[model samples]
Target: MNNKTRQFFVAALMAASLGTVIAAQAAGAVESLRGRDVETQSREPGKYATEKDGPPIERNYVQQPPLIPHKIDGYSITTNFNKCMDCHSWTRYRETGATKVSLTHFKDRDGKELSNISPRRYFCNQCHVPQTDAKPLVENTFKKAEGLR
Candidate 1:
């Protein structure tokens, strides 16, 4: 084989063993898994929130942690998320007792206060989400800051 090709192969082996790679080489797909990207290159990060019942009577104070009682699998979470604001928006929240969304939702594109859900705050899943099925993966000791306050 050519000396340059042989040199490159030897360099790649050394880099792999070292666990560090340049940006260009790292961006390249791994040779072992060229076509399949099941667990290697899946989209999105962060786990879904958990669903639970209301807090105890003694602890059942104001602004209770919202209960996510419904399943939320494969639900479209795009930039313009209509699936969420349909119910939780200020206009419809009162009709269902679903809690009025933030006042910021009342503003329009020009920042003028409108009487409806603003396009900016329409994506409810960005801050809130309903829980789905269980899949035991890793454990978490992290807690919410609100619980401390």
Candidate 2:
């Protein structure tokens, strides 16, 4: 077809698609669960039971970062201050009985090691998450590693 004819057909097709969507929305045909059980169910309180010296959880897969085993309720981790470093830094771990931050945390994106935790790895929460005893919000079908199984 000619350029003008092809453009006209494309514009008409777009208009038809938009009109169909508008009509469906106006007719209340859009699927929504605004007042359904999933939406209206009473929410449980946010309290979490923390385990400080509990048995270590097995990693689900290889290279899975270990979950935090203790509560970090009042810890501050701003650009200027990382409370986790007080216990987990290399200099303090030996005395504080806390695990040392991984050597990888000291390396930058280029793999050059620094005297301190790399900027990229300074945020402990990015990889380490505290464990909670709360029930799963949804059913999970995850399987553990072969050795764990």
Candidate 3:
């Protein structure tokens, strides 16, 4: 109730909070995968060491965006210049043999079709990721659609 008593109570509360945090850390309650002991495990293996030189993989589910089959190093996807359009745009697909940008990419959020790739879908990397042979960080037991197999 008095100033001295109130100050003492606040100090005790602060000390108790600090003690709880220190105790949790000592007990390994905040362990992180990246913070594991180096002696117990080596650094995570680098990205898939080799790029596959085969056909694009089949999609496991409906509406799945196809994966990029080739390297996109140095490609730029800036608003002023989308390098992917050089090969994947509708006008260029026929000559370049690159897959055409999907019609869906031309649709606005309200479903009205536009003349070009939608602003929201302009970045190819947002949904379509390049396939890498990287080892899984965790086991994947996902099952494909029945007809896909």
Candidate 4:
């Protein structure tokens, strides 16, 4: 209502508006590791060599989830159906020549064992990726544990 009060409020509002604009511009300048705007949809998958069906790759460390050795393109792994189970299920692995789903996969988060793959462990690709020809985004010098070597 007073001149000084009105002037102070106006100055504060303009400063806040300027701050917001600067922040938005800064955000837009940042690119994600995938080399795209953070908010954008991921780029289309790139062409990578699909590894042929083979024996399981050796683990680099204890307790590492095994890397998938075969191409799994078009595999369906939904809540109701898991294409992987057709070959990797305990009942089918022997005949299919696919590695059986790990025994650990049957344990609940609470450590109780179930008769089938626990829901928490049902999505295989969540932790396991098929080995491909794609290079790492960053360089690393990691090595296998001495025991594994």
Cα lDDT tens digits for candidate 3, 12-75: 9999999999999999786654344323333356324324445787899988999888767678
Question: Can you write out model 1's per-residue Cα lDDT over 102-146, one digit (the tens) per residue?
Answer: 776678878899876666666666555454223445786645456
Model 2: residues >4 Å from true position, as ranges?
Answer: 1-48, 52-55, 147-149
Q: Write the per-residue lDDT of candidate 2 for residues 1-149, one digit (tens) a residue.
A: 89999999999999999999999999977754322222223344433355555655667987788888776767899999999999998889999888889998899899998998999989899998876555665799988778766
Tell me the RMSD of model 2 versus the true structure.
7.7
CA lDDT for candidate 2: 0.77
**lDDT (tens digit, per residue) of candidate 4 on 28-65:** 85444445332333334532454567767789999899
Q: Report lDDT (CA) for all predictions.
A: 0.55, 0.77, 0.80, 0.81
Q: What is the lDDT of candidate 4?
A: 0.81
lDDT for residue 31 in candidate 3, whole number 0-100: 61
Candidate 1 vs candidate 2: which has greater lDDT? 2
Clashing pairs in 4: none
List TM-scores for all candidates, in order: 0.40, 0.62, 0.67, 0.66
Off by over 4 Å in 3: 1-46, 50-53
Give the winner by lDDT: 2 or 4.
Answer: 4
Candidate 4 error regions (>4 Å): 1-47
Kindly give the stretch of ten consecutive residues in candidate 1 with the minimal lDDT sum.
Answer: 33-42
Candidates by lDDT, descending order: 4, 3, 2, 1
The ten-residue window of minimal lDDT in model 3 covers 34-43
Using TM-score as the yardstick, the better of models 1 and 2 is 2
Question: Which structure among the candidates has the greatest TM-score?
Answer: 3
